[model samples]
Every structure is written in C-alpha cells, then in structure tokens.
Target: MTTTASNSLQNIVIYTNNKISLDFYKPFEDGLNPILFTVKTLEQIPRKTENKIHIVILESCDELSNLQINCNKIHLIMPAFLKNKLENDLHALIFKYEQSMNSQQALENLYHSFIKFYCSAEYYLDPQDFFNSDSYKDGYRCINIHEILQDNVSYEQQLHTYLNTISNTETVSFNFSIGYEFSSESGYLQLIENTVDHLTYAKDRDVFFSVVLSKHPLSDNRLAIVHLSQ
Candidate 1:
C-alpha cells in the first residue's frame, strides 16, 4: 500500500506504549504515513505549530492529561464498535474520510471526541447487516439507542458503566439533546429524570432501542449508540 493509494488530507496520529501492537498499525503507516508513535518509539511528535487536523488514537487508556506535549491533540477514544471490526475495511474507510473531510462529528452535535471515532469507523458499517444479527453469536453487538437524559454526569456515567461491564470495552458513545427551554444542566437532565432507573438496565432483552426520542415535555433528544458485549 502507498500513501498515494488513497488521496486523503487527514492527518491521523496514533500513540501507544505497547510493542506488540505495532504490527496492527503497520498497514496504516504504509498506506497513509500517519504519525504513528509510542512513548519511546519515535524521536518526537510533529511540531505543534503545524497547521493540520490531528486525530489521536490511544491503544491503551493511559491518562495523558498530565503529559506535556506541544500539539493540542484531539484524542478520540476509539468507539467500542470499532475495536473488533475488520482491520482492512477500517483502514480503507479512514483513508476515504481523510480525502473527503466530511463527517457528522460537528460541534452542534458535540460528538467530535467520541462520535468522530464512531463515524470514522462504525458509521461505515451497513445498517442492514447490523439489525439482522439479533444474536451475539459473534460476541459483539452494534447498539443504536435513542433516549433522554436528565443529567449530563449520570448519562455519561451509566454509559461508561455498561462499557466497563463489556468484554475489554472501554469506550462508549451517545447523543444528548436539550430543549431550548432548559437553560441549566440540572434542568436538562430533569427532562429524563423519570427514566433513569430503566435506562441503567438498557441491555435487558426486552429493551428495544429507539431511533427517535420519546416526545413529551422536552424539545431536545439524546442519541446514544452504546456498543457493549457482555
């Protein structure tokens, strides 16, 4: 594979401290020449002053907040759905994204951190293929659920709890909408106050995920696609 093989303008930066994982990224390096590196693997990262869209992937969830790096790296925690997908397919999709630079990870949606990761990977999956597999015979599930959340912290927390319970899963994602009326975080969360307990058990067999939010006294709807494998 060659960098010119796919004409994309995206700059992907992948960092990790694990050695065995380098082979997993060699394809990306040869295909896109992405800024792939581990702590001691590379001499140094690209200059912070470079004008480029940086997408960082962490192989391990090591807390990088304290690390002093010049580049304002946008670390996109890989979505659960992507961790186990066809490696070759994922590589090709990412290259296309670079060339187009068009995605659903907008600020208004606020999905850049997590959703971009999802879009760059799972968004390419055929929806028809996903809904048809009702059983976890393959040990994974592509969950698409829409729900309301009463609090930001609670919503994100419960989302993480499910991920933690899944097989080697660490990343979870969802969209949360707020009515134009709710001027405060507490108030926005209150909209889903009544459904908190039920949402905690979203994996139950009887729970049917919705593509649309339940219209009630709220104007904002939250969309969440939590890919968890119990």
Candidate 2:
C-alpha cells in the first residue's frame, strides 16, 4: 500500500515500505476520517505491485508546498551516496534561508523547508554522536544528538519546556500515529485501538510522536517524535 498527500501541483510521498500492515494518523478534518489507511490483506499483494493512493486533507494540503507519499511496497530510485549528497545540499540551502529570516519567519520557513527537502526520506547520521550532540555547532541536519536525547526525554516535561521556550515564536500542536504488525489472531483491532488510546492520552504536546513497529532488522519498535514549532 502507498499513502500520498498532494496539492494541485506538488505531491509528497510520506512512506514506502513493504510491511504487511501499517497505520497512521493525520489531523482531523470535518468530512474525512483521520485514519488514512487500514489494509488488512497487504500480505496477499504481490511483490513489486505498485499501487497508488491519495488522501486529501484540506488544511494540510493548504499549508503544503508539495505532496507527501508513503508506500509500503515501492523502492526509492536514488543511490545512497547521491541521496546523501542531495540531502546535505538541501540542508545547507534551508540553513541559509533560515539565517536570512527573522526568528518568527525562520521557524515558519524551517517547517516548509523540511517538508520540501526531507519529507518521506531518511538522512544518514554518524553513530558516534558527533552530529546528535547538543553541543554541535552545525544545525544543518535534523538527526542530531539533540534530537536523539530530546526524543527520550519525558514527554510531559519536554513538551511543556519546549512550548514555553518557543511560546513567543510560534504556537505548536501534537499529533501521533501508532503502527502495529499484522495479525491473523482475533482482537488485533482491539490491540490497535488500545495503542491509539495510549498515544492520544499521552501528556506531551510539544513533540509530535509516531509509533512504528516492524520486523525488519533495520527498523525497531519505538516512538518516533519530532518537535515542530512555529
């Protein structure tokens, strides 16, 4: 299954992995369901069978400059080395733009910049904490030590602190989606429902969290959250 968000001109592909089951949440819309896709028979789909699905979130689309697409079965074409170079260049461009803007505009520009540059793609980071550390002077990339530590912080305290720090700049909100493995056993839906409940009831409002579970060795079951303010 593939999930994509697009406006009239640009499309953003959010995810593209060949996992049997996936779940995600987007902001609520008056006439649309927040649960984007709930495919139960994904395992039956043949490998390399490309399928396209699009969702229209009016508000999100309005703010978006490009469409985001997430696929469960498609392969991204770019080579790793080239992709990294492109990502780094994009980061530099964004940083330069941020430096040119005032604080308030910088924040807004940062969001749009990320959406344009890094959405639906993974960027490489050094495992030695060289880039992740808060002391790092370079802030050109997103996967730094500051973000790793920030993700592990207590949701409540972190959210409150982040909001307070950025309060003068931009208003922020949190959204979460819990993705679980596919199950043939009964009560699978109930399990997912409970997980969603836990995420919704979570006290964090400063960092948006996304919970993903996969059997792939490269991936792990954990909450992937990012702070988005202004």
Candidate 3:
C-alpha cells in the first residue's frame, strides 16, 4: 500500500463503530480496494496488518490519546465529517471555476482547498487554537521544510526528528503550497516534478502526500503537505 499516486491501487481496511454507512467508503473504492471492519474501540484494530488501516472515529477524540497501534499504514477519520466536507468544498470550488473560467480564482481555490483539508485534522486541537499555537508557524505545521532546507539537511532525517518531537501522535498531516513568481507553465511543472522527487525519498514510512498545481504566485513559490502514521 504505497501513497505515491492518488489513482494507485491500494488495499484498505476501514475500522469503525458503525458510525458511517458503507456507502461513505465507496468513493475510495473507485481506484482502491477496501475491506470493512467494525470495531467497538480503537483497541480492537489490529496492531499488525498488510492492508492500510483507516480508523474512523465518530465520537470521542480522547480515544487517540496515548494510542499505541503498530502498522505500516494507518489513517484517522476524526470527527467523521471530514470526507463529506472535503468532497463538498471541492465540488463547490469546481463549480465556481467552471462558471467564471477565472484562472486566478482557480489558483486561490486550489490553495484554499489544500489548507482546508490539512486544517480538518482536528483530532489533537481545534483549528483556531492549533493555528494560534507555536506549532503552526508561517503556514507550516509540525515540520518546517524551509528551515530544514536552509542547513542543507536530509528531509527524511528532519521529518523523523520532527515527528519524534510530537508527543502522543501516531499520525501527522503536512500541507504545502508552491507557486512561481514568474515562470512558464512548463517550468512550473518541472519544478513540481523535481520537488516531488526530492521529498518522496522516504519510501519506508507511511506518509500520504498531495500536490496541487496552480498559477498562484507565492514569495517562495512552494507549498507542501505530508500526512504520516505508524
């Protein structure tokens, strides 16, 4: 179960307390195969599995505290509404882009979409409080790639060190936005490709990454998101 591409085939195991209907998991099946498992609590989820584990928690966020699940691949569905909201927001943004055919508007939507999705992982802290905390600095959360790059560091080592600093967290989400101050579309695409080549070096870790291309300009022309679980 690799997170290299969105359409890549993956075997998923869904763990839930029957809070969500089977229909909700159907969309993921479009490109991946999923096997459903209903568990009364997180403890019931297997510590070892060949399939990707997705823990869907509809009720208490406290279940995540002091957690100890050992798996190569794991994800969390905290609050239970995140998937539906993401789908809806993306749909709305598509409609808006189609109606206006405004490229800038599309770029803005692209940036907001990733940010919103990253912020939706509210299992540890409320979005507002999380943003206000020292962990969230200059739009980067958990690990700051920019700081790591300044010292000519290894991203994998830096990522591991940062993940170790986070206490009681089994999963971490990363969101990055990259833009070009002035470059051709081909140039931007090349930059994106190169950036991905550099970041996806840690193949042994269970990390999910998403990259969106847009014409929006940023001071540094780069944005990134990395979600990981162990």
Please name the candidate that would achieve the greatest lDDT relative to the true structure: 3
Off by over 4 Å in 1: 1-143, 147-174, 200-220, 223-225
Winner of 2 and 3 under lDDT: 3
Worst 10 residues of 1 by lDDT: 88-97
TM-score of each: 0.26, 0.23, 0.30
Clash count in backbone of candidate 3: 13
Candidate 1's TM-score:
0.26
Per-residue lDDT tens digits for candidate 2, residues 33-135, read: 1223433222232333233221111112222224232222221222112222222211111122223333234323332222222222112111121122222
lDDT (0 to 1) per candidate: 0.32, 0.26, 0.34
lDDT of 1 by residue, 1-230 (tens): 01112233334444333332333233231212223333332224454624333333323223234233444323333333233332221111111112122222211122222223222221221122222223333433333323335445575566545444544331233333333444665653554343334344433332222121222335334545444232
RMSD of each: 17.9, 17.5, 15.5
Instruction: Predict model 1's lDDT versus the native.
Output: 0.32
**lDDT of candidate 3 over 1-230, digit per residue (tens):** 22322322333344544443333333321122223334445566665544332433333334545344554223333332222222111101111223332333333333243322322221111222222222222322222122233113364465455555533332233443333334465764564454445442342333334333324445433334333212
